[model samples]
Target: MQNDIPVAVIISDNAEKEEDDKLPEHKKIVADWLTEEKRRYGSSLEKREREIIREFKEDPSGVRILIVVDKLLTGFDAPRNTFLYLAKQLRDHNLLQAIARVNRLFDGDEQHEAKVNGFIIDYSKNAKNLRDAMALFSNYDPEDIDRALLNTGEKIAELERIYQQLHGIFNTVRNRKDNEEYIRLLEEDVVKREIFYELVNKFIRQFSACGMIHDFARKFGEKKLARYQRELKKFVELKKIQKIKNAEEVDFSKYKDQIRRILDKYVSSEYVIELSEPLCLSETEAFNEFIEKAENGLSIKSKAEAIAAQTRRTISEQYHKDPEFYGKFSKKIEDLITQLKAARQEDLKALLDTAHDFQTQVQNYEDSDIPGELKGRKVYHPFYRSIVSIFSHYSVTSENICLVVTSLYDIIEKNKIVDWAGNIEVQRKVNLEMEDYLFDVVKEQKSIPLTIEEIESIMSSFWNLAVRNR
Candidate 1:
């Protein structure tokens, strides 16, 4: 325990005498260390020992490190503490209490600023013991454990499917002469050959046990396994060929490079395109904005709620104008219904055509007043396309958008009228329903498990930095 890491042993003063005492050895070890320190320092030990221990117990600034063996874990509160290296085995309430010592809030800290890192040195073989230890302090719930296993299984299943597809493509390509020529060119290019090898090797290693590609060969069928090995060997041979110049050195190097290059080009254009895009700057900006609003104690959820209310108000106003304004709105509604019916059986492309026809009809109407100013705005075409595409292709319900938009349109119409005739009671009900639906969606998307205090601290820090430029 004391080879390189600094050591401290804290134990209950009355560990041997206490009625509930069960850890006598723990007390003895700590007591022995303290006595030795006392002897080494002589009479001077009396002055310094109590003060040093008390200050450590206090754990103020400049306490760079601490390595504990049982003692100070129980009722300790050290805000500056960062790491919790668990050398001793622990579980249940005792383990919970020990880890909690490092989780205390410190000054100028944004909630979880203290990094409670753990290093397990003893229970290396017992994975269950390590998991049980984690359950003491973290949210390692049973359901979470099941979900993690399910995700792992799904990943393995997906990888198995991809391997099968790749093998099918490889078999087809291997029979073709032109594909063989392509492989030759890839072999000639060192960079291209390396890329292809890495692509195969990464997937191979991901499924590999103990970092061995041989594990993949043993698990999958021999035919596909042989192909991977064959291709991989070709790649390595090409790498060697590129460096060789003389007749003896040239040997099989040129042949290997030529074969590998052909295979590399095929894999890239066919297989790699299907993978999901990595996070980009636009996504980062969206996330940063969200975090900023959270830190400022501002709620996008609440703003959306207010928008729902405004939408409802506009709908109420629009519904009040007699058969003149009302008639015009009803026409748009009829057109929407007609297009929706067309979209029901149509695919995305056909649905877009139907939406375009309806929009074109609206444009042709001599009575229309949708404003030329709104035409060709970047969002207008996209918004219309999204509406049509989602209605025709995706699973998201279009009723939510219609209910909110229609309600808002009605409210705007009502406000324009000198004398309103639409039923106020009906508008109120629609408004309430819209609010309920919008709030439910917001809650489903944004709800988190942190305490209110914790959330506020995180949001504040996030916004201060994120909104600084905005």
Candidate 2:
């Protein structure tokens, strides 16, 4: 017996109303256990219950089992809660709700097991026949209920099928065992990679569910399952790299523990590198070191992807403030990636050099031509950049653009109240005033005739920058 597992026992409460305070025998047992547990932590009963629930939801070692009868059968959702021990009879909605407690898909992370399927250990003998227990669902047909609960054997079979399908996608790889080969193969074929990833995810889910049932692993063969786990871990690592390079957000909170476990079992410490946090482009040394480490650790294509993704993120953050400067780098990075992909003969050294060169360009952009005084004005800088970019193309001089932008910036800043972005009426009034200033004062004074479309475009750009930066 695993006594180390944390458990919450939900027994029947005899008290029907707030005035009635009678307790049942099972409730007393549960209460005594809670009291003993609380003494160790030095918390009150109410405080302890809250802690238990929190731990059950978050910390893996905190709570292992929740023994519930009536309470938490519905309206309670804890994705990490993997098992339920049923000691009381349940019917209809009650049974459906109770079983659903463990059905949540959980990603395995550092602290807990990846929840595959909710398990029920029935001691009440009320759910002996699956159909009989579910027959009370008058609203749903028998086929619907059957679809919800697949037997262990059926789930195992599905897992095996998916595993095979995943391998079949990688048949083009000359060396299936080579991690680099698999990475290259996946990078080249977008459709195949997508299918492989989807199939493997499906396989992991089914495999995890089947793992809870006794003799299921034996029936599937432990050797084969271990092989799948090993291959899955490799694919997951490659997937992470791909995601990072593509600037895709990967949420690993639920599955981090499970992924860590797989890597610990199969991969060496030298190979186990956690994804680096978002790098600050301003910190030249740190950013360079990040790129260097990535170059050393990853394939050329992977390194290129990571650099491009990070550069894109940097541009996205600073683009509004210095659109002209950052926008150029954004286009440059995009072109570099496109050129790299189109190259027939891949040169690792050349790719690495080009990526570093791009990083250098991004870092050195502060030296770009922008008036020194306007650089310090954070809020107004974006409007100035927008004005410079829009008007500089025509007869409008830099000196005149700066003067008009400065005045407009002052007028907008003064009128912008607290939460002005949320107030549409204020925005409308501000827009009208800015348009009047642009056309009446600036346009007439500078003798720069503008079309309605051009005026609207410039105003729209300036207004958006102001609101977003605000």
Candidate 3:
């Protein structure tokens, strides 16, 4: 309900009939509403209640909040429940049972929503009720009871502790202003990188949560708060740098809204993070400029790492555009990396040499190793590569390979039509043409010994690549 998400409210159909009470129709109305999703369901209300509860327990997007006057306050158990908003007054065992709803631990899910602790917002001024309930219903000491609940001031203290820990990692650098040094240290090892990511992400979440409190802003003051805002920006840029240098898929989905809140609250719009994406290989000047602008103290290995990461990223993203063509170069670069990693000697210079070659190759992919006849025919290159890949294991000579590729290209060019990739009719026609040519021309006329199964496999790859190319 906080961000336009739907909240679920469950009313017990099991409530005792109150003939003497006002609003006698309330229970039935609520029961009908519970099952009234989409339309009024014909199923039993209790079954529908269990279904919603199950959804809330398992799905991150399901049932953000629960409003219940009774029933569920007792037997309902969901470890994923992280927050409880109490409005009705209850004491002793009932209050204790309600408080226990959110006390369980959950070690994150696939959506990355982790629950280390629970929160309770007492709207009914339940301070006295909580203390009284503990004193009357529990067998615990006074100070022990006090430890169970904390004041809002503790949130500020926790935020400060996380901030200090996050900055403590960078204290080794004499020049704190040198962002490259901090990023390089993060890239030094995977553990440090993970710790940095965890701490900074926690800091941002804490800051976002506490910023809503008026006292938090007043306590930190304007200047100190501005400094923290800048720190958020710094963390964002460092994340971007690490992602590109490591070629990791960092999930920023969790912080999308929180980051927008932090930036929009500031006076200047200059604090915005506006970079398009990871540098694309096709854009030479921009990509080179990004690589050249690495941190000041980074070694030659770091530059090469950036190039390799970007090259891999480019191949992965653009592979679909021309899989047969990109597939060839992708294999070459990965083989080079595997070879470098497996080498007995640490020949980083050689690694750097290979990485630079891959970078240039990505930018000039169409210019190298193309068949003589397919040299100016860039549109036919991917198909030609597909043909080459299919016949690569055979003893077919280079001239014979070119001859097979151009013949298939002519067959495809003549049969292909508008939107040929999606049109089943066009694909069927192309497949027939390819199969006939492979059997009639490639098998009989050229004396190639390819099997029917091999011909089908090649045609399958071609059509798949054709769909992607489209």
Candidate 4:
């Protein structure tokens, strides 16, 4: 074993000679071999050679294989460890757990191929019939025993079927040559996009499994398998682009190498597309360039969506600063997208021009009629909008409404302490004071009488807005 592969053997020391003497002849021989092997390895005879096994498990560069009997099978997990030689007869959960030691998914650090699956060399012929071994768990479910393992051919067939299903979902798209057609088709129906995602995940899992099985290329012909892999890469790139355009999170570092393998082998280097870095919304020139590049690369529909998504994200982040201004932009962008989709604009150049114009408008937004007193005050903006929303129905002058709302805003701001929303006593006091001011002062001075229910409703809206913007 040492000549061909780096190997270590682990077994019980059975150091007590009198206790060893009482054991069976076979057991005594095994114990003696363990003791001699430990001496040969020049390891200290402390803790029954546990330290040596620990070193062996940790340092994969030094030890390529480990031979063990009745130890280190359970309570051991090493992602880099693959391949097990099972000589001992293990049954039930013991057998399942033993094989699982090597079944863990492992991605190689810069130097090695990933450990996709564990291989078992069954010298004792315990796993010759996997079904019989798994049959022991029939109490769990008899049918589950067969589902525990799938041969290479079955996995390949399932992958092919899933790939076909993905293509079938996009059958309405007539032009397969244009990549944008694929994106547009998916964008038109959210359900189809979701199904595509689900199928792609299933396909990837099976593709990774196929890497571990022997003679996969032969079972699933080399040319056909290569085509599937190339298509899978394309789908993955599309998904990445969609995620980025929507401001969705894209973290694939764990599966990066596995994906790279498919691209490196089957896909052409020149044809491979990488996801662009995230857009910096604060930089005007950089942002415009990003949108221009997106226009050139993606379809008209996708370009519109990408711009709209970024605009929406910007509005969400800056809404607290200027609620009324950003609110209008949000509504305008949403309306524009609805119109574009309804028209089905196919002229890419026209679409890009329209999108750029909208992007410019969003960047250069200015509030027209905001009172000069509330211009730079962030906290008062939401209060102003809330007031306009509530009192616009009544026949009252804008000046008088602003004056009364400003007073109400001042009262709420003064009483708000740490977590005032959560404090019932604080809320009760604030609500009563607001009611008194609105009914007594505003009703008498402004000649605008409000009912009890109206006062309560206005107070609720004011406090809620204050809490959100505070």
Candidate 5:
């Protein structure tokens, strides 16, 4: 019956090359349905984007279609974009952002309408298994939500019972526990704790998205667990209101806000701290040394120290000019630049100036800093080339761009030593890694919230395999 509904399928990628395409034809078909009515919308983007955006602009009854393989997943908007057919596996903030595509309001649509209207008709077999994953954080009630989930109703009901049992155990503990209630409490604690942990593991199995999991985990598992009680109570209250059919314009704002607060708290406390601390420490140490040396009243290091520093700088410059080196780092830089250009609201001149600065630095390094060992024989500069490439990819806030370029320069100065024979290879390798470091900083500044793991797997992988080769 669901498939029997009149649906317009949109095909963005060539259906024949299903494996080669990022999204399969089946999934792309759903994406295409959402954007089928192109001209009805204000302006036309790529035929691909139009296909995705059109569904929102014009309402064609019974037109329940699917789209396959498209790039309009981000930076596009449509109020009628109520249904998001997610065939893709997403993680971190990306998962949230993608689903958010359908969360915007329509004319009479209020909070719950906006929230629940964002449906995902998932045909992707893998995606079906992961349906309950996001619901844990999105405050989605398994029963209230439609056949949105792919598994058996009984399986989902069982999972709910387990959660309910855990809640009951928690309630039992709350009811008693005098000074002498040690043994029973401890025994129950172990059982309850196991259930709690198992719930977390099961949640993870359903939702690969950490932003969703970490957000819900803290609410249900960590600090102020009373909030979870409150939320669950609210869920019960909402079900009653819906059942009465007398609830006019349900206020999901309070509930949505509570969940959002939990998410923010989890992100700030759990995810960001553990993931970023180590990298931040390393970057700070390297930057601190550079700042201190640059700031010293005057400069006349001991001969030994000067020799060591100069040799290191020389080796770094030599490695920068290596052909293999350029082969590796150039395209990542360009991709970074392109993303900046696309995302940011900056003046053209300012962007060009930043690009010029990167270019000048690269040229200067090539001509003056590259070691004589690799001179006259056509050496490449992957680090500098990468800088240029990344600059091209993104259009960033001027201040952010300034910070990024300065950071890139600092990384080169601190890590790369062109003259040192002993450290040339090491410096070169570090520069290669710096691409990853610089890319993350730029992405964050652009307000693109990605997990370090996602950054490494998606953006970094894209950089290394596609950008570098191109």
Candidate 6:
């Protein structure tokens, strides 16, 4: 009760035969627990059952233990239930159902390690009963059941193999203690980093399994187990840094917190890297602030990679915002990374400078590209660009293009009713107005050689762009 860990003693103590103090110590303890349970819910059987079950099912921290005789045996389903303490004897389907209580698959988010397997701690001497039931349950495949029910030794052996393979990733780093060298090796080879992620995940799963399988973990010995904890910690941190160094999405394992707890329990937490969500590079100030913070903690090379990853993602997402501008800087980032990887540009400062330059260009791109006449004209800007692009071969002045933007915008703005974009009649009116402006004003007077096909193409594109911008 003091621990604030809710325990549900789901037994009907409606009318006990003996007094609470007179009962045996264990039973008295249970009686005292039952008394609290009754107190909490106040003699309301329906409320008690519902509240207890609700807490146990929904709240991960609530109802850590449920002293159920058999109420939950059949219909109750809790995916988080990973352990079953057997104290009573049963046979066949009843035994199978009881064991199945813990057999439900469990998955965890970033706060918990996934429960890879269920555990049955038998105090009822039910091993023979379990095997007998499984064997005789003719509905189940004997071979399948045998494969699913792993004994302790098998789990330990599997853990050993996986742990060895996990450490094998960094075997090339001559100084096993040097984290930088390990990171450097991963930095050079992306494939090795991928392999490390997969193997480390398996190792965590296998290690988690061996650690939970009763007393069998003792066979790993104190020194060997300590070594495992240390190496696992090192690998987990390495995996974390590499993910950042490469600018991978923040898909850190749901099991990280649970694994961290396990490691912190056994080892020191000295070399841990904190994870922050990947920021949007389009949010220039936010991106700048985030990078400023990274500058304090991240290495020059890592900071560069982080910047590049973020910039590329933003360019992809905001490409529609300004494809011509975004694509230009996107190419610049690609070239810098290629040169760095090819050993042509080893200076990390150059990468930083390029990124800084890109930031300036993107922020000022609107000011420089949008003429003073069309300044603050958001819809007219793209329209003007489309005119400039479509009539690039002709000698059209910025003033003339601005006039075209005004004319086309007025036509679209006037006809844009509730569903004007989809309404073909509204579209035809817009296209005809645009065609008249493009031909009589631009082609006839300005002599830009704008043809029928070009006018139609411009109308379709400008209509779509207007639909989006407006």
Q: What shift in Å separates residue 140 of candidate 6 from its native position after superposition?
A: 7.1
Instruction: Select the stronger candidate by lDDT from 1 and 4.
Output: 4
lDDT for each residue of candidate 6 in 309-399, tens digit (9 for 90 to 100): 6667666776665556677778977886675554433577777777667656655455357777888766576667666777666767777
- State, as a TM-score between 0 and 1, how close model 3 is to the true structure: 0.60
Q: Candidate 2: what lDDT?
A: 0.66
C-alpha lDDT of residue 274 in model 5: 27
For all predicted structures, in order, the TM-scores are 0.23, 0.70, 0.60, 0.65, 0.21, 0.75
lDDT digits (tens) for residues 214-238 of candidate 1? 2433455667545654554443333
lDDT of 5: 0.40
What lDDT is obtained when candidate 1 is compared to the true structure?
Answer: 0.38
Q: List the residue pairs that clash in candidate 3.
A: none
Q: List the residue pairs that clash in candidate 4.
A: none
Identify the runs in model 3 with alpha carbons over 4 angstroms from their true place: 1-16, 19-66, 74-82, 104-116, 123-144, 152-154, 212-215, 218-222, 260-264, 267-307, 314-367, 372-399, 405-470
Summarize candidate 2's per-residue lDDT along 405-454 as a digit string, tens digits: 78777767878888887788877887898899889987787777776877
What would the per-residue lDDT of candidate 3 be over residues 1-470, giving only the tens digit for each residue?
A: 76888587676554335432543576556644554642554555666678778878877667767777677877789886877888777787888898899998765543434455677777787767878888887676788656666545777788889888878888887888776678777876688789888887787677766665546777777887788887887776687667666666555544554566665666343333343133444565565575567443345566667777778887988887677667777888787667655554467778888888888877666647776766887666777677675677677876787777677666666777777767888888888998998999888987888987889987887777667765
Q: Model 4 reaches what TM-score against the true structure?
A: 0.65
Query: Each candidate's lDDT (Cα)?
Result: 0.38, 0.66, 0.71, 0.67, 0.40, 0.70
- What range of 10 consecutive residues in model 2 has the weakest lDDT sum? 12-21
Cα error, candidate 1, residue 438 (Å): 69
Give candidate 2's TM-score.
0.70
How should the candidates be ordered by TM-score, best one leading? 6, 2, 4, 3, 1, 5
**How displaced is residue 152 in candidate 1, in Å?**
15
Give the per-residue lDDT digits (tens) of candidate 4, residues 1-470: 56876776666455555587688898888777766766876665545456556655565455666777666667887776767777767776778878878778765543333554666766665653455556655545555544544467777777778888978987887876676787777777888877877676566656766765678878888778778877887777667665555645544444444566555656544443333233356454665455456433576667777777766777777675556668888887787677666665566456656666666755655455557767665456666766675566677776777787788888887887888878888888888888889988887766677777778877987877776666
Residue 185, candidate 5: C-alpha displacement in angstroms: 52
Which runs of model 1 end up more than 4 angstroms from their true locations?
Answer: 1-7, 11-32, 36-62, 102-127, 130-140, 143-470
Report, for all candidates in order, the number of backbone clashes: 35, 10, 0, 0, 54, 1
